[model samples]
Target: MEETDHPQYCGIGIRGVAIGIDSFVWIALLFVAIFITAAFTGQLETGSPGLNAELSGAPASMALGLWFVLALGYHTVFEWRFGKTIGKALVNIRVTSEDGSSLTFTSSLIRNAMRFVDWLPALYLIGIVGIAVSGQRKRLGDRVAGTAVVGS
Candidate 1:
């Protein structure tokens, strides 16, 4: 195949940095949700209760559910529609099919779902190792989904 037929695979370092950026964004949103929920429910009173206690309440449960949905949606929608999340776009990398075609929703869902496994043993140690060992720099999710992260 011609060089153009195969996009450049993104290495673990850049991918890690991109994920770090995304994680920061997610955390910020989570905090905002928590504060908003707390404010509405009068849980923000000084010294009324611990932050953890407040977070374990109904509003926090809603926020947690929202976070879960948002996290899955973030990856699925972005990868399926644009082939990149905000962080991936900023980093100039994207998820694509092994054949370099546009990514599909099913593939995106599969990869994102497999993230549970990738996150094994904390901090994605398994994912990092998978990326390192795979010739195409594919993480477990990528391998399972038949996709790859590539420079755009």
Candidate 2:
């Protein structure tokens, strides 16, 4: 009857590990973006050994916005298209609708957007609590989006 009744849910611990892997990947991509941006903006020069990361003002704001967009898009695109990110696939877990179907683009976007709330007050502390107590092993994002992360 309700959308939260997912079967074969995974524990938050495994989810945590999967997210760690995903985060690592995101950070790597971001680093590459920063490197390229710096080069194009002339922050790097001939004989320069590394990128200068001390950029500020409008450039810093733009970089921050780019980071947010990339983070959102990374999760949204992977979950919508593949049901799982690389980390989730590697960990044998996936995001699926509450009724055990592939997530829609809307569902994935809603869930990923809620990631900010899930991280409120700390590093996913709210999400961890939600999963630990939601009875369906879901975080805020999953509940909001009518989705679940479960064994693949």
Residue 116 of model 1, lDDT score: 77
**Model 2: per-residue Cα lDDT over 89-137, one tens digit each:** 9999889998888999999999999999999989899999999998889
**Candidate 1 residue pairs in clash (backbone atoms < 3 Å):** none
Per-model C-alpha RMSD: 3.9, 3.5
- Reference-based lDDT, residue 46, model 2: 50
Shift of residue 25 alpha carbon in model 1, Å: 2.1
Give a tens-digit lDDT track for model 1, residues 11-106. 889999899889977887677677767777777656656453266667778778777667877888889999998889889999998989888899
Model 1, which residues run further than 4 Å from truth?
Answer: 32-53, 57-62
Whole-model lDDT values for every prediction: 0.85, 0.85
